[model samples]
Target: MLRLAWLFVAAWVVPALAAPPDDPLRSPAWPYMAERYFAGQTVRFDAAVRVLMPGAAEDPLAVPVYVDAGALADVREILVFADLNPITTILRYEPGELARPSIGFRFKVQQATPLRAAARTGDGVWHLGGAWLNAGGGGCTTPSQASGSGLWKDRFGEIDARLWPRADGLRRLRLQLIHPMDTGLAGGIPAFYLETLALQDSDGRTLARLQTFEPVAENPLLSFDLRGRGAVSIRGRDTQANRFAGTVAP
Candidate 1:
């Protein structure tokens, strides 16, 4: 009958329309990134490398994220990325021999997306952790703190480093840098930030390196674990090719 034919068509069409589309975050793009970054190796889910952030970001421009890999030893590097941001890779940090395996920093969230952290071990395995952050939007394209009148004129290109003693016989190294970190999405603001950072010992041996992108918040705060050290020094350069350095003794 005509009624039976219509019902059959409706059933087929409804299911097709209702079926959810593939998640773009895990599509071909993710595989390509995995191949490039991890050399196509499998990333295992790990609870030790914890990615802690708020369920909902109150301030998308300055959302705080803490990556704790303190329990894991022999950590070579840590990488952080956002699934929905225009620039997917946010930060790449290489911890030093005596440096602690924990870091805390702030970043911009464009929208609701998965923020992932990968901790690479000495054996070349990457342990992954992720969390979702719901943002109200406009975190990337909005005006920055440096865009304000006269804010960046005198305060730019400054570095501060400090070392503190820990109960575990390790030292905690904290570094802060003054930079605008403009994302270029905002009107008339070119992308500018510290692109590379390195820590070294008194003998000029490199300890660890860091690579950062525009998603980093203005005036980045970085912490690292440090072992025995007489004097530790840091050197870095920004997008404008401005070099800065600082030293700390514990």
Candidate 2:
């Protein structure tokens, strides 16, 4: 009876294992798309870096993505991209000496696509990680309802930051910035959003730098990993050439 039960389990499991993946975003066509975007650059599949996102996006306009490269040492920068979005390249992040090679942010998913994170270490190898997110559509083309009349008249560029201790002895810093992040896709709205952000310590030592694009959602929210506990500050510049700065306490 036990032998028959074992055979029964294998009968069902073998065919399932042999079946092709259901999501088109995870299909073979993604590699061709990635190659086109990289433009002859080498990308190696490495498990050291991980991209985390929901299997299916609940909200196409505000999908959360996390890239964790803590297992990799001496990482210089991490580049995030979505294969099927109108704007493929998401953000480029350069981590400082005391900063961890990890970042979390909310972004717009144009459709079902493979989201990738490439971490370039000191040795010059681009280690890649990816995740597939399924969405209905219209993440970029639709106008944001949050950007109503006079909504950002006085509250633009405001930042709120906080630090929370993690279980692994690493600190997580969360930051929220007020910005329109207009993609210029909506009628009559020109592109107006934060383009650059720098994180530094109280003594002015740079921690991390971020180059962002219009795909980021309205009122951008970001999170980073810190090695130790201390006060930190952030400075940013928008496409309009306006600058803003704020500090976070321990």
Please name the candidate that would achieve the greatest TM-score relative to the true structure: 2
Those runs of model 1 whose alpha carbons end farther than 4 Å from true positions after fitting are 1-36
Tens digit per residue, CA lDDT, model 2, 50-140: 9998998898888989999989989999999887788777899999887899999988878888888889999887788888788997877
Backbone clashes (count) for model 1: 5
Output the lDDT of residue 31, model 2: 52
Instruction: Indicate the worst ten consecutive residues by lDDT in candidate 2.
Output: 18-27
TM-score for candidate 1: 0.82
- Model 1, position 236, has a per-residue lDDT of 91
lDDT of each: 0.81, 0.83
Q: Judge candidate 1 at residue 159 and give its lDDT.
A: 80
Candidate 1: tens digits of C-alpha lDDT, residues 35-104: 5566645476687888899999999898989898877879999999987787778999988775666788
Clash numbers, per candidate: 5, 0
